[model samples]
Target: MKLWEIAHSRTGDKGNISNLSLIVYNMEDFKEVKEKITAEAVKKHFKDIVKGEVIRYELPQLGAFNFVMYDALGGGVTRSLSLDKHGKSLSSFLLNMEI
Candidate 1:
């Protein structure tokens, strides 16, 4: 399923980097998410569209997961000119994601 379909997302942009905070619902959901959205999976999905790092965090107490994607805009939070990064928008790209 799409990212939004599986979890809620909060996005912030700083320069060329975009941070995505994902709050998953439960353990089952988290497992499914991890299985489908592996680091390699993200790299392939955003290969040319984003640069930098994609970090994932697990919050067992909150039953949530967070993803911090860095240098997505080619420069990072300090030098990106465009706030919207083309059709490869986070929300849209997320729709194509299985997790």
Candidate 2:
């Protein structure tokens, strides 16, 4: 199943960094997400666009994970020439990932 069915996302961006928070629909799903959604996996998933490292910050109590992606915006909103400079659509792309 796609992660979207079990999770939702919130996003923030500053300069070339994209902060994507993935919150599971239920606490029971935390283990599944934690196991499958590693920083390495995310980095591989977004490899084409992400030029820097992917860091995963765990929020176990909240059943959530926040991924900080560097060099993801092509540079930054104001500086990037890419169409989706803020990389907001990347959140939706991530939601479509299958477990």
Candidate 3:
């Protein structure tokens, strides 16, 4: 199933780092999200876009996972040649990931 079935996400960027937070709608699904969505999995998911490391922070209290992706924005927003490279939209793309 797609990750979005159980969660939603928020995204932001600074320099070449991209931030994405995956938040589950129900706390009950938190365990599965934690198990399936690892930093390695996410890094592979966006291999074409993210050129550096993917770091995941588990927020059990919030039932969310915050990911820090380096070298992800083509050297930041202002420097990226692609118009659709905004971090905000990439969060949606990540929702398409299947667990």
Candidate 4:
């Protein structure tokens, strides 16, 4: 199943770094997500766009995980000519990940 079936996401960006938070609807879903969603997987999923590291933070109390991707914006919003410079669309892309 897709991750979106049990979770939602929020995205933010600063410079070339993008932050994406995946929040599960139920605490019961956290363990599965935590086990399957690794920083390496995320980095691989976005390898074409991201040039640096992917760091993941586990928030068990909140039933969420935050991923910080470096060098991911093509540049900053001001310098990037890409339509989605802030990388907001990445959240939706990530939600499509299989569990």
Predicted structure with the largest lDDT when compared to the true one: 4
| lDDT of residue 53 for candidate 3 | 96
Instruction: Find the 10 residues in a row with the least total lDDT in model 3.
Output: 81-90
Q: What lDDT would each prediction earn against the true structure? A: 0.65, 0.94, 0.92, 0.95
Q: Candidate 4's residue-wise lDDT over 31-60, tens digit each?
A: 999989999999999989999999999999
| lDDT for residue 85 in candidate 2, whole number 0-100 | 86
Write one digit per residue (lDDT tens) for candidate 2, span 14-94: 999999999999999999999999999999999899999999999999999999999999889999999888888989988
What is the per-residue lDDT of model 3 for residues 1-99, given as tens digits with 9 covering 90 to 100? 999899999899888899999999999999998888999999999999999999999999999999999999998978898786667888988999998
Residue 31 deviation, candidate 4, in Å?
A: 0.5
Residue 53 in model 2: lDDT:
95
TM-score order of candidates, top first = 4, 2, 3, 1
Displacement of residue 97 (Cα, Å) in model 4 is: 0.6
Sort the predicted structures by lDDT, highest score first. Answer: 4, 2, 3, 1
Cα RMSD to the true fold for all candidates: 3.2, 0.7, 0.9, 0.6
Q: Estimated TM-score per prediction?
A: 0.70, 0.96, 0.96, 0.97
Error of 1 at 94 (Å): 2.2
- Residue-level lDDT of model 1, residues 4-55, one tens digit each, is 6767666676666566656675556877776677666776787876677777
User: Which parts of model 1 are misplaced by more than 4 Å?
Assistant: 76-78, 81-88
Indicate the worst ten consecutive residues by lDDT in candidate 4.
72-81
